[model samples]
Target: MKPHRYEEFRDLHRAGAPLLLPNAWDHASAAALATAGFRAVGTTSLGVAAAAGLPDGTGATRAETVRLARGLSRLDALVSVDIEGGFSECPEEVAALAAELADAGIVGVNIEDGRPDGTLRDLSHQCEILRAVRESVAGGLFVNARTDTYWLPGAGQAPETGERLDAYRRAGADGVFVPGLRDLRIISELTSGLTDTPLNTLHAPEGPSVPELAEAGVRRVSCGSLLFRAALGAAVAAARSLSVSADIPSYAETQALAGAFA
Candidate 1:
């Protein structure tokens, strides 16, 4: 990665407008996004796992995550990876994975506190993992600490959200991500409470727009699994459209898209 890429990615969060980050699954998706003028891209753990026929958010795709990171290093756009729960319960192991991703030219990573069994990880242990990852990357990687307070069923309330985020910030997280959080009022409160630490939230199609999110003080808006899921839907639609004919990219065009990175 370019020495300034990390700083460049960081600056996006501080810009006047909120950063609209799209997540990609593989080289073609990432390269296509970059070619279409997206400055930064992130990998969706669901996309990575599903593409490899594995389960997502269950520590089944660590090797696939790392391998995809290495391949994404070739893309022109800045890249961040979603490492679901860091694939381990050990802080040291999670830190080592972060380090390896940094070495692979990943500018950032999203390590969530959500676990495989539909529950959140212990706050103290999650903080330790964040601290270890932060120290491992030496500030070279943007560690976006993700909390599942809003994602997991009956996890906690709004007050707990602020508390967890506060602990993560103190643990050296560069940013805090809250997926499934859509209330503008609560989002504003969280951003206000966070102060300088960027607040990232997943974009919901039925929720707020980018401008609405920006106005609510969200520094980063992630597409999460939306794009991957949309792609799957599109593929099915295209197959069904065979009779009516669809305007899908030709084989050569698809090859050229992948070849851009090559």
Candidate 2:
């Protein structure tokens, strides 16, 4: 009953070393990331939702998320799906979805408790979702329980962060993700509070670097919508530059950048 992919992903969260998870939006993006030597790739919910003309965190891109997961799972990398709020409030439904993703070759899933209406779900309910998903996957999938206490304005204070993360770990969460947190002191405090679960934080260009986060006890750094947004910005800037400067990137350089995905 050894879950090879699950153990591999779990091992990526090595205490203070931290794994760098660059999220992908589509097949090409994912393939490119894998080609770039990233061992694991996660899907950004915003990238998938916005690309489909739907608002994020509103359960609007369930089908697109699943389709993307199915495709990305085939890549030569461990795939994790960012299933915002589990795409349902019901624990049973969320568990079912997790099972489906596991069957589709997804080794991990990030489930958040923040609602689209600018509110976080009750702690008890979120724990229920985590527990159900853990049971459904049965160690075959890594359930990264995500708490938006710091992301949602007026949600709660720092102490609440530890409480929620501790509760999530007790409810069978393999890892805990707290995005929108950048302070190194606070990151260290939260990470120190967790004994069994690994701490995951969002990556910010203006904030602490990956090395700094690892020093602060973070076990995983997720580049959540950053890569997707950067890719979009790069596309627009490249197009604009072509109109202004005749010195565009050489075809060989572009092909090299595309690597095997090309």
Candidate 3:
């Protein structure tokens, strides 16, 4: 692979088989997924921020996010990073970061409209960021435009979601993503309405499953931060259980379990 190919990503999306993207927070997590046969891996903004001791969705971890992308760039997996709101409102600044990610061998990124302050950026502003990244990245990197309309509760969701996707597509996004859309009817409608554009949807326990989304014409299924969060919860539960039970994973045992990564 040339380490960058939007067409490869586009072809995968057009396959309609549900491209499953596992969001990895670190080198081991990403390398493990690559070794386990995932064709592509994405970095969860939540995971990246939390691991770096920063609040996610706040665009406060740009340096850490870029650093992690640089690390994952060394692996063989196709890489796409979740750059929370492009880490800045300035379109060109986001473009510079996208160029850095591309130089590090990442093939794609998810830039959302939601800001850390819990308010969504304006459509024009979001589109400007998308266009800047597209123009800066030399057409080889996939830019997944993510709208917060579906994720955040508010008025004018349905129309706003569609409008944002349209603007983002016009701004040169390779795919449009709605992270919290779970209704089958809405998913079908979105896919039908945007027939020429690829759709990416986030999947969690309560969301539509991969099979359902594939049937609904969703091209990419992103795990976001669910896997990482689950791992955290499991570790906490295991430790709590050990405090009251005889079962325990010692340091050596934990190392043994992690030997595959080693």
Using TM-score as the measure, which candidate wins? 1
Which segments of candidate 3 are over 4 A away from where they belong? 1-4, 243-262
What TM-score would every model get versus the actual structure? 0.96, 0.92, 0.90
Candidate 3 per-residue C-alpha lDDT over 135-221 given as tens digits, one digit per residue, 9 for 90 to 100: 998677888999988776573578788888888999999899998888888888889988678899999797777888999999999
Candidate 1, run of 10 with poorest lDDT: 241-250
lDDT, candidate 1, at 166 = 99
Record all residue pairs in model 3 with backbone atoms less than 3 Å apart, i.e. clashing.
Answer: none
Clashes of 1: 0
The whole-model lDDT of each prediction reads 0.91, 0.89, 0.83
149 Cα displacement, candidate 2 (Å): 1.0
lDDT of 2 by residue, 1-262 (tens): 2289999999999976899999998887787788779999999999999888999999999999998888877788899999999899999999999999999889999999899998989999999999998888898999999999889889885888889999999999999999999989998898888976899999999989999999989999999999989878877987887553365445674565444432
Question: Over the stretch 1-262, how does candidate 1's per-residue lDDT look in tens digits?
Answer: 3458888999999634988999999988998899889999999999999999999999999989898899989888899999999999999999999898888889999999988999889999999999999888886899999999999999995988999999999999999999999999999999988989999999998998888888889999999999999989877887887542465566887788866876
Residue pairs in steric clash, candidate 1?
A: none
